[model samples]
Target: MKQVHLAAILCLGFIPYSLTACHAQNKTSQELNKSPEAANSTSETVTTPSSTQIQQAYKVNNIAEFNEPWAITPLKDGRLLVTERKGRLYLFDPETKKKTEIKGTPKVAYGGQGGLGDVALHPDFANTPWIYLSYAEQGQGGYGAVVIRGKLDLKQSTPQLTQIEKIWTQVPKFSSGQGHYGHRIVFGPDGKLWISSGERQQFDPAQDMKSNAGKIIRLNDDGSIPADNPFMNQGEIAQQVWSLGHRNPLGMAFDPKGQLWVIEMGPKGGDELNKIIKAKNYGYPLVSNGDHYDGKPIPDHSTRPEFEAPVLDWTPVISPSDLNFYTGKMFPQWQNKAIATGLSSKAIIIIDTMQQPAKEVQRLDMKARIRGAVQAQDGGIWVIEDGPQARLLKFTAL
Candidate 1:
């Protein structure tokens, strides 16, 4: 297997408000206007470069470096909490150049693609000090993705997690392979929690109504099931399901218009960018633009009109890791663009979503396997790269 450092925060302590317990998801990514579909698509094709060469934009500033960092989350006070794959969470201040290891972080599997994953702040962090985390855990299945909720107390010289509790986990637990533990967690437009549960390389479960694997789920902050979920009529597994049929989904965020979008790693050449709809099936193993590793062909989305297809996809593959929509004043011209990191392509992808069938306006060559992307509180784009000694970089106007 190849070695990589994959990529975390919501710390804007604003006015405390009570959520009526009904719902939540506002994550910013690039903006795009959809108007047309061709071939097997339901809409018009987003422009593909006639020339396969990538265009570079923006210079990178090496803010700091760490060992295999997985996520980069920002607090309102401009402090960053970064998680490493080997089970360490560090609170970093880009301004102060300080790094403090956060205690009480859960132990991670650290095998293949498994390990400590995403960390996000509660949507209402001002009132509630809850912090959400997703990581690979040892259980009935050889290893499974797990989501846990906790409160991080940073009052003292040391920071640590308190009131920790499990929010979600992969059912039937064991996976034969540890390469696909997709545990990206994002809050939707509603107040509910949305989790990307990978298929665990177990193809059939992506379409299984009885399993949480390969499904996008909705949950209350306290780990309770939401009442209005689409699959609530079914058994336990289906009750929390919001959408089904996915591979290893990592990048999940809602655009300004409240539309949920996710980027999934497809087998071979079919990496996909999808607009997530409630209860929709995003044909994974059954249908994809890419095929099996052995070169076996899977039917395209056109073969199944019942399935939802990708808004855009990569043929040569970029190995997309994290997602961020630029809405800050620091990079004014980059506003409304979905900025994502490409591991294989060694570039930063900037998608122009405002145009009909969003275009890949820029691909900044970073010369490293970029793993995570986030817009920091200081209005700079922060990213973490792959491997030990990986650098946390800040990108601004050249």
Candidate 2:
């Protein structure tokens, strides 16, 4: 077991609407985009105000560290399941500051944003103890994202996966650069599994109904498509699509109203926060608030009346990694607020999603690139940092 070191702690009153400039070099070492200079610019800053007056204090505690951790989900018991980018899963105990590696993980295409991604427990986890995972895998053509679920066999000392079965696989794997395999998974309120499939940095596939890439998919727990899906009659591939034309949707969450919202990184500046509607087309590649990496300008969403527009978009780019609505009673002030972890910005930007145009109310300045966050069973938040030797932090109301 490795020793857990406590880092500098932060305890502060909730402040309103302030953000530091993100790092100019937005891409990571293993990021598909080699030219870090071509990422987003760090010049502009936008501050949005909050309507709430109640201020709550919270403290941050450095829990544990992992190698390039991607996503984390809380177990019923006070433990957590975390996924590392390079094909590893961990069962972490926050109290003991100890971690146990889980076995039976699939081989991933590990590089440049392709690897083991999101981890989610089935809604009926207590009775079934099933776990869902999303990762990138290679085939004849290239690598694509896929979803798998297996029962967690905890009877033994070491946790292991049993009855492993792949549920969904992206269509038409491309040999293009290995990036944008957005495989975030969450079970909706209706008990349907929802997944975000990135377009593999391919422009046209976002609009191509023949491919499942660059789309939101809805399916049953057994990997079967829902009969009432919008494109059920369109074709085999289109039948799984719940929404289309997404660029690199990494973060997704359902509000208390059961409405889904997504956060995606833009090419240069325009990071987006969109309210996802069923069967709607969010114009990507064709229309964006930002331009191409090479300075090629794409039309703004306003130009396209047919396509759906984001409720709010960021010009300077937060490079959001994950989204979760704070429902825990610990942070009463943040109830129902959306917490978006940032990569380039290195902050946790909290937004009031219930507003007409979602407004960012608070920005917790974490010096490290934040990856994934989930509410703890005790109404706290567990956040994982990015890259090797990153820290796992926990926040609780003070």
Whole-model Cα lDDT per candidate? 0.74, 0.81
Q: Residue by residue across 262-361, what tens digits does model 1's lDDT show?
A: 8888886677888888889998889887777776888877789889988777766677788778888776656777887767665567776666666566
**Per-residue lDDT over 1-398 for candidate 2, one digit per residue giving the tens place of the 0 to 100 score:** 11111112121222333423333334421233111111122122223232233345566666777888899998878988899989999998888878889999999999888899999988988788889999999998988999999999765699899899999999989888888898999999999999999889998899999999999999999899889999988998999999999989999999988999999987776788889999999999788888787777888888998999988777666788999999989888789999998887667877788876677766666656789888999998898888887778788754
Candidate 1 structure lDDT: 0.74
Clashes of 1: 33
In candidate 2, which residue pairs clash? none
TM for candidate 2 is 0.88
In candidate 2, which residue ranges exceed 4 Å CA deviation?
1-56
Q: Each candidate's TM vs. the true structure?
A: 0.85, 0.88
Global CA lDDT computed for model 2: 0.81
lDDT at 35 for candidate 2? 14
